[model samples]
Target: MRQVDRHPGKAEIPAGELWLVVDSGVKKWACLSCPGGCGVQISLSLNPEHRPRWKVEQDFWRRPTISPSIHQQKMCRCHFWIRKGQIEWCKI
Candidate 1:
């Protein structure tokens, strides 16, 4: 998927897509349609107040670079990481 800095509500983000929602220039959070075919909206904070948050960076190509990893403790329980615009699944 591609990266966008738009106000989340204004964009028609696709399913299983990654969206970077920000306020002004500060990244507020990252969101995506759950990749496990659950169709649930998974949102992770980039704010310092939330623990175990993630970060995102984008290159000129518009692809995204996400850091650390993402682990869903809830439904589907998917675990993976996005690095340099590629999703790397964790063998969990």
Candidate 2:
């Protein structure tokens, strides 16, 4: 996935029909979809104190992209995916 800065204009990141990575740190979550386009949201907390969970409904969708692939999409470095529990340590 391409990394992007989390500025005022850049908040939401859509991860195709697979998943959408949201937020950072131990309490991270990704919005997923079933094969038939059914929404299946799941969250995973890398920290032991936190719990890995799943949500049925999420706010993730396919955003308009100039290019087809996510790699070709323009994004800020801060908007990329960081390790589940190590997001705080990530640097742009």
Candidate 3:
């Protein structure tokens, strides 16, 4: 996981399948690569003004957890949540 001001900035968006990119602190955006290995990047908005946004919480383990689930309407059709630094996929 990497904290960046801009996507693909100094960071390469780690090649790890489950890599995360946090932009402008934890409130700007939380991005991740699609688990489908389709080389697509997913961006979750944290801006309150945005119609659909996600919230990130920290567990006792300091692991990042995302709520309300992530559903991709396009392409791979992946749906899941990140809890305790793990991806818990929901039935698509």
Candidate 4:
């Protein structure tokens, strides 16, 4: 799992995976790779509300077509971005 700068407490929950966290309602809840361009969705369940806290639809990946960064050079499809921690899917 990797922690993103924007969301210091939140980490990439991994593709096709789900994670649950209990928040104190002071901080924001979000899915790491969703809005950034990854074709993944994240749903959160909060105590007063049972709605999706963050959701990234698969179609989001088709539009805007964000390119990989220089750090991802020569990496395979399975490789992806993780700002805070190492990626289990990709190892150098």
Error of 3 at 23 (Å): 7.0
- Stretches > 4 Å off in candidate 3: 9-12, 15-26
Runs off by more than 4 Å, candidate 2: 1-27, 53-92
Clash count (model 4, backbone only) = 0
Query: What value does the lDDT take at residue 78 in candidate 1?
Result: 88
**Please, what is the TM-score per model?**
0.76, 0.24, 0.75, 0.24
Write one digit per residue (lDDT tens) for candidate 4, span 29-61. 334334334444443322335343332212333
Q: Estimate the lDDT of model 3.
A: 0.68
What's the best-to-worst order under lDDT?
Answer: 1, 3, 4, 2
Who is ahead in lDDT, 3 or 4?
3
The runs of at least 3 residues in candidate 4 whose Cα sits more than 4 Å from the true structure, single-residue gaps closed, are: 1-8, 23-45, 49-92
Report the candidate with higher lDDT, 2 versus 4. Answer: 4
Candidate no. 3 TM-score? 0.75
Q: What are the C-alpha RMSDs, in order, of all predicted structures? A: 2.9, 15.4, 3.1, 13.2
- Going through the candidates in the order shown, the clash numbers are 0, 9, 0, 0
Give candidate 1 regions above 4 Å deviation: 1-13
lDDT of 2 by residue, 13-61 (tens): 3434323344452223333222122333223222335443332222234
- What is the lDDT of every predicted structure here? 0.73, 0.28, 0.68, 0.33
Candidate 3 lDDT tens digits, 1-92: 45566555334344433334455454577777776556567778777788698887777876878887988767888888788888888974
Best by TM-score: 1
